[model samples]
Target: MSVLVVGASAAGLSTVESLRRKGYREPITVLGAEWHLPYDRPPLSKQFLCGDWDEDRTRLRPDTMLSALEAEFVLGDSAVGLDVERRTVHTASGRELQADAVVIATGLRARVLPDQGGLDGVHVLRTLDDAAALRKDLLEASRVVVVGDGVLGAEIAATARKMGLSVTMAGPQAAPLQSQFGPVVAGLLEELHASEGVHLKLGTAVTGLTDEDGRVTGVRLETGEVLPADVVVVALGAVPATDWLADSGLRLDNGVVCDARCRAAEGIYAAGDVARWQHEDSLLRLENRTNATEQAACVAANILGDAQPYRPVPYFWTDQFATKIQVHGRPSEAAEVTVAEGNLDERRFVVHYRRDRRVVAVLGWNMPKQTRLHRHHLVHA
Candidate 1:
């Protein structure tokens, strides 16, 4: 029996590697939509965009190392359809491959702004090519307006400022990262960005774009104000790449709905950003990089009928302007945040997020060990 993984990034690659390591010698095939080998994406907005690291540095594993997985690599070929009834996969390149088991890790595609035509100098970072083009634009750009206040937007805004470009960030929230870090921490982040010379426009929505001769000149705000910019980066989040599974009947909602084991159907499973599995009284779908690897590993075992539930604490981190914010567990549901270690004035502290007087999550600001230590409290909670 062969296993087929749809996606060539961390989750797909992890599934392949885990299966091989588990003594499964069955044939495995990985299908990638991108033309290049699978590379790490976290660096695209940081070291890679800053020119501190090259493309090779973003590789999760060397080509030679991945080649040793003994699986067929179908790079540049996208899986357009899945025939779950016939156990067949259809590719855009006209290849009809049969598989005994199927794994969907299609990940996500960047969300584009409404009514924005393909204007030059307007960019979104997701793929290597996206970063390459944005990097080129950043080096020559004098002023940039970044739309969105999420992790991607904040990171790009920080990177652009570090690149010596004047950056003005338009956030729909009162403070950037308010949804993820809450008001207290988010207010601090807003202040940090201000101190670093990043202009912030809070509670403002981007109305449209100002284009001149097929190039975006600036971004128009809902307030009828325009921020002149040589380039604009849309860091708005993303949607799951589940359009191909529309006819597959795999129960698609925000993503591919799956059981606790990451199983979508008989002999079919999903991992990474595309899988929303049942978790602790709710359906949790994490877009975190660590979740991708962990969920893929669980899916690999569950594919072999191990029956292990894919229960993860949901961990993620972000680095901005030398400040590292690490978080573990479900902080979104927390009603209170307490300083577990260190003081807030130091900007290097660990805070515990509590829900109903119980520790639900932990966040560390430049305190890695403390964050990890508190993560243990929620392991069996």
Candidate 2:
């Protein structure tokens, strides 16, 4: 059977690799909007931006490895529309392809602030080119302001400070990452960033971008204060790349709505950040590298008639300077958080989050081993 995968990132690549492992041995095709090969994204604000790892090192699979898959790869061409009735995909490069089965792993695109007035220094990090362009600016920038409170913003602020650039992070939340990790853990992170010389302007809104002669000079806030910045990186989150599937008749909520088996429709499946499926009686959408890999494998198995539910304990990790933070399961669902190992004073610890007298999740601050030992508690949580 001919299969068409509409993305070539982690989720799309994992699906193809896992399908081969399942012995499908059929003709497969991958369509990618970016010309570069699939590359790891976690390092965009870490090693890649820091110039510690070159672009070549970020590739998920080398040319030699990908040649073994024997799949037709169409890079630098984006799929513009999908006709599910005819099992056809129309591409921007004027190609019409047919497939017996389709996988919509098109993933996410970074959200941009339209009112930014098309300033030269305003950037959003999402693809390889975005990071490369921002990395060059980071080296030359003296003062930078990041507008977002999520993981990407925090990581970029941390990376900027590490590069000796003065970074001021502003977000609407009361504290950074409080919504995801809750108040206690987020409080510690706030202190960590403060100690490292990052100016935290939490609970603030960005009013506008101040530019001089078509170049961003600072970011204006709601409180009538303009934070002077040589460069501004908008790390606002992403939305699913689902516009191509608008007329395809598949359910589209926050992403392509899928069933417990990750089936979007007959002969169609979805995985990654673009696929929001049922998990434990709730519709959950996870946008992380770990979940993308797990969900893709599950989708591939279900496509191969394995008849298994794609239930996974969601996990994610981020790096900020010397600290490596990892979290398993949804800690925000827990009402109480208790320390399981190490102490915050030592800058290394594992915290256990519990709900209704049962452990639900674990968060680690440079303590991966202890956090891993407690993962079994989440299986039934």
Candidate 3:
């Protein structure tokens, strides 16, 4: 059976690779909106943005490996519409491609502020082009204000500080990732950013952007305080890139709603950030690199008649400064965090997040191997 994959990122590539590995040697077509090859995104805010890694380093695979896949890679053409009944994808360049099965892995688009448009120094790190533009402005910038305090914002702040720019992190949360890791671990993250010369401007919302002569001058906060900046990076999260599928007749609530098997329709499946599938009692959508590949594999298997459900223990990681933080399982803000191994003050430790008196998540700070071992606690719990 021929398959049509609409997206050329990690999820789309993984789906094609998995299909071939599982011995499905039918014709495969991969469509992409961007001109570049499938590339890694996690480093866009850190290594790629900071000039430590070039554009070539961000590519997911070399040309030789991709050539071996024997699949058609259609780049720079976006899928604008879908025919649910006929399983045909209409592209922006007016090409209608029909297949036996269609996979939607469109991923996400970075959210931007209202006043961020038409400004010279405002940036958002979503794609490689976005990263390149931001890095260009950041090289000539002296002061930068990052508008968000989650993982992406924290990493951007750390990278800017390392580039010798005056960086300020602005957000409404009590600390960085407070809603994800709760007060204790997030507070420690705040300390790490503070110690690394990133000014903490948390607990307040960013009102707007101040501009002068079509260039950003500062970031205006809710409390009437304006943080001066030569550049501003808005890392305020993202929404599923499903606007093109508005008339597809498929369920779309926050994302492409799918069944437990990641199937949206008879021959339509979804994976990655754009897919919200049933997991046990609830509908879940994961927006990490690991989830992209894992969910793609599940979708590919089910396409090949495996009949398996996609149930994964959530996992994500971030590198800020010299610390590498890894989290296994979902940890709520209301969960109680307790040290499971090592000391919190020593800056290298593992902690368990408990809710309803049971371990729900494990987090490791600067300890990779030990933290992975402790992840078993989450699986057993």
Candidate 4:
């Protein structure tokens, strides 16, 4: 059967690779909006932004490996519409591709502030091109302000500080990743950033941007104070890229709603950040890199008649300065956190989050092996 995947990122690539590995020798086509080949995105705010890794180094795979897949690579064109019944995808370049089975993996678009558009020196880090532009401005910029306290924003602030620029982080959360890691762990993270020379402007909302002569000068806060900056990077998070499927007759909420099998329709399936599929008794959509490939494998299996449900333990990781943090399962701010291993004061520890005596998540701060071992508790619980 012919298959068409409407994204060329890790999710789309993983589906195709899984199908081939499972001995499905049918024709496959991978469509991508960016002109560049599929690349890793985790390094965009770290290695790529800090000029440690080049564009070529970020590539997911080399030409020789991709050529072995024997799939048509359609790059630099974006999908404008999809015909659900006909299983056809309409592209911006007027190319209509029909396949027996279709997979949606469009991923997400970076969120921006109200006045962020058309403002010079304001940036967002999502794609490779975004990293290149932000890095270029950062090299010449003496002061930089990051407008978010989430993973991306914290990472950007760390990278900029390491690059010797005066950096500041602004967000409504009390600390970086407070919502995800809770007050205790997030408090430690705040201390780490503060010690590294990054200014903390937390627990306050950013009102708007101040610009003079079409160039951004500073970020205005809700309290009427302005954080001066030569460059500003907005890391407020992202939303699913499903505007093109607005009229595709598919259920769209936070993402493309799907069944436990990840099937949105008769022959239409979805995976990765754009898919909100059922997991046990709840609807879940994960935006991390691990879920992309894991969910794609599940989709490929079901497409080949495996008929297994997709239930994965959510995973995500981030690197800042000399720290590498890895998390498994869902950790909420409301959950009770307990240190399961090591010592938090030493900056190498593993913490477990629990609700009603049931462990909900595990986190590792500079302790990868022990953290992974603790994840088994989540699986067995």
Candidate 5:
């Protein structure tokens, strides 16, 4: 049996490794558009941008690790099409590979401001190349403007502030991460950034970008105000890289829809940001590393006839401005949230999301023990 994986990021690499660990020993091949090995992306905007880590340190697995698994690595090549019926993947390099099972872990790509004329100092943090370019500019930039108030944008702004740059965040929302954490918690985040000397231009829209000689100079807001920006980073979230599978006959909504077993179609499976699975009669997709690894393991086990469903609790972590935030399980809108430990003013606390007096999720800041305790409750609740 031969297994083909379309991506070589966390999801793809984890799936391949898990399958090998299960003693399948099939002819596994991993395809990636990037030449670099699978690497952790969370550091791209934090340690890596701050010059605290190098590429070698960010890599998920060393060369020896891939070699030990006997998996073929096809770097700098993209999977352009999939023959679902025949179980073949057509690559952009004019190679068609046969497979017994295929895993589409194409993940996601950063959303770019295309109409902004692709200014030299404007970038999106997604790939290693994007990080490298932004890092170079960040080292010398005095003023930085970040578009979007999502987790990625917030992290970038925090890092820029730490680097002594005058950071300005512009987003349509009232506060950073308001949609995810609600207005109250997001207001706290806004206050946190404000205390760090970062300017917040919330509930605003960008009209266009100002450039001089192809270099970004500032951003023009819809309010007719121009903000000076030596560097601009757009973190408007990501879109799944599933355009290649358009004609593959697989159901695609926000992502490739899959069953509880991670099965997209016969002889095909998907995990990671590209896979949307049925969860409690609702379709859900996660864009976190932890979910990718867990789902991949579940898919591997099911592929080997384990017959187990993929239903692990979602978990994610982010480090920004020296604050370590960890989230376990999915927090629904109707969940009753309460501060379980520490104080938000102290920047150390755990927020528990409860439903029917049972904890369903927890968010912690520098409180691992409390987070773990609530995580256990979430798992068994």
Candidate 6:
């Protein structure tokens, strides 16, 4: 049975590798829209943008390694439509490929501001191309305005500060990462950014952009304030890249809906940011590299006829301003959070989220041992 995988990001690549390791000798075809090989994206905004790492350093697997796997690599070709009835996929390059099974891992695209002029100085970092362009702008930019206060935005703001560029972050929340880290931790993050000379404009919305000669010159906020910026990085987040699956009828909400085994429907599966799976009696979708890789392995195993379910704890990590933030498990809304080590003043600590007297999630900064202990506790709990 031949297996066809669409996309070359973390999920697709993981699925291929896992399948190969499981002794699947059938024809495996990997199709991707980008020309480059599958590469790690976590370092794009941090190390790559800061000029601390080169392109070779960001690659997840070298071409020689991928070729050794005996998988057919089709680059620069996007899967435009899926013929589920016939178990085939139509590519943008006018090729129809039939497969015994298919995996959709298209991932996501960077969210851009709407109704605003697409100027030259506005940037969004998602792909390698995006990171390269932003890195070029950062080299000569004196001031930068970042929209959104999520992990990506926070990293960009911190990187810009390190490069000696004045940064102003605008978001609707009261503080950065309020939704994920809680208000108290967000406050600490705000203090960290403030210490590095980052201007925080929380509880504000960017109404529009001011342009000169078709290039962005500044941003106009809802409060009628125009913030001058030589470069603008819109890190609002990402949306699933499933527009091509509009007529596929494989169940899609925020992403391609799947079961706990990463199976969407008969003969089809999905993994990565573009996949929403049933977890904890609800549809949960994670847009992190860890989730993508884990889910991909699940898909591969199931495809090999091993009916093993995917039960991950939902872990993620981010490095910003020389600070490493690691998260393990999904914190329930009713979970009570507690600090286990260090404090905000020390700039290093571990926060544990407990649900029903059992630690379910742990977030740590420079506290690897504590993080590992909590992770073990959750796994055995």
RMSD of 3: 0.7
TM-score of each: 0.98, 0.98, 0.99, 0.99, 0.96, 0.96
For candidate 3, the per-residue lDDT at 276 reads 100
List the pairs of residues colliding in candidate 1.
none
Better of 3 and 5 by lDDT: 3
> Mind giving the per-residue lDDT tens digits that candidate 5 earns over 54-118?
98889998889879989999999999999999989999999998888999999998887766655
Each candidate's number of clashing pairs is 0, 0, 0, 0, 0, 0
Candidate 2 matches the true fold with a TM-score of 0.98
The C-alpha local distance difference test score for the whole of candidate 3 amounts to 0.95
Model 1 C-alpha lDDT per residue in residues 140-188, reported as the tens digit of each score: 8999999999899999989999999999999798898888778778888
* Candidates 1 and 6, the one with greater lDDT: 1
Q: What lDDT tens digits, residue by residue, belong to model 2 across residues 59-160? A: 999999899988888999999988887778899989998898889899999987777747888999999999999999888889999999899999999999
Candidate 2, position 116, lDDT: 74
Question: Candidate 1: which stretches are off by over 4 Å?
Answer: none
For model 1 the local lDDT of residue 381 reads 69
Please give, for residues 16-89, the per-residue lDDT of candidate 4 as tens digits.
89999999998999999999899989999999999999999999989999998888989999999999999999
Backbone clashes in model 3, listed as residue pairs = none
Writing each residue's lDDT as its tens digit, candidate 6 over 171-277 gives: 88888888877776678888889888999998888887888998888888999999999999998999999988888988989999998888888889999999998
Question: Which stretches in model 4 have alpha-carbon errors above 4 Å?
Answer: none
lDDT of candidates 1 onward, in order: 0.89, 0.90, 0.95, 0.96, 0.88, 0.88
For model 5, the superposed segments whose C-alpha errors exceed 4 Å read: 332-335, 355-358
Candidate RMSDs in order:
1.1, 1.1, 0.7, 0.6, 1.5, 1.5
- Candidate 1 lowest-lDDT run of ten: 329-338
